[model samples]
Target: MHFNETELPGVGKKITFKNSEGIYTVMILHHNGKREFYYLEDDDDDEPLFSTTLTSEETKELAIKLLGSREDEPDDDSYDHMSLVRKKALVNWVEIKDHSCMIERSVGEAQQMAEEEVSIVAIFREDDLLSKPSDDVMIADGDTLMVLGRKKAVEQFENICKES
Candidate 1:
């Protein structure tokens, strides 16, 4: 794959490339150590189909996972992208709505309500990220949960959250 880099003058640098699937990808490395990513249908597209911003630390973590560091190796329960597809395993984010049944419940209580094999990996509460949060942590409305499990189990967990 060929990569093209351009300077953004007062901003930083812009890198563009096409992945194996021929989807155009762009990365903007800001001077302040922030990274912005975008995907386009074509190189000349003026607007991105999707975009996201990542801090320096988050970018480094994503790089490590992509490059497969020894410490980041998958365990028995975890699978690579291809393996995950074959096993129907999934990692999903579920947001707690105001009317959801999970609201006001503790993390452990929500887990018990699902009664599935899903694992709540982390909870994103506004600006804070609670990684491997304790079971006693309250599940407030508007909290985003990162869960991992088989497709069916995860779906069941999502259904539990939607129940009132």
Candidate 2:
């Protein structure tokens, strides 16, 4: 990878990296803590094939994602690069109600996942995110579960969780 750093004068700093395959990846960091990312094909045109603007926080999050730091980090790839086959599956969110039957049950014990064919990918409780929770992790009231599966199976899993 060859990286070229240049100052954009009134804007900020711009860093461009050309990989071995000749793909150009550019990131421009503005003085206001905003950032712009660009992807260009290995061609003659200087225009970017894809671009997105990110805030300071979002920029940090994107850095973390690119670095593949931890398991809790969200797995998000630019939709521009996604293949058609990956666009079929759907991810849904289910909130566990306080009076629901799934409360106080461990993920393994509830068996909602096994029976419905839905997989729990992450759990959100208050300000915390529990990513790829183990079977021993207990489901709690008000916890939001990120479930991935076919549409029908996801709906079935939600119905099971929302049932009192």
| Model 2 CA RMSD to the hidden true structure, in angstroms | 16.6
1-164, model 2: which lDDT tens digit per residue? 67789976434578988877777888876543457788888635566888888865687677788987855553344321221223355565577999888888887676554465667788999889999988789999999887776555765787888778
Q: Per-residue lDDT for 25-125 in model 1, tens only? A: 99987543457899999998877899998865677678778887848544434323322455554666688999999998988888877666877889999
**Which regions of candidate 1 deviate over 4 angstroms?**
1-84
Candidate 2 colliding pairs? none
RMSD of each: 13.7, 16.6
Quote the lDDT for 151 in model 1.
61
- TM-score of each candidate? 0.51, 0.45
Distance (Å) between predicted and true CA of 13, model 1? 23
Give Cα-based local distance difference scores for all models. Answer: 0.78, 0.70
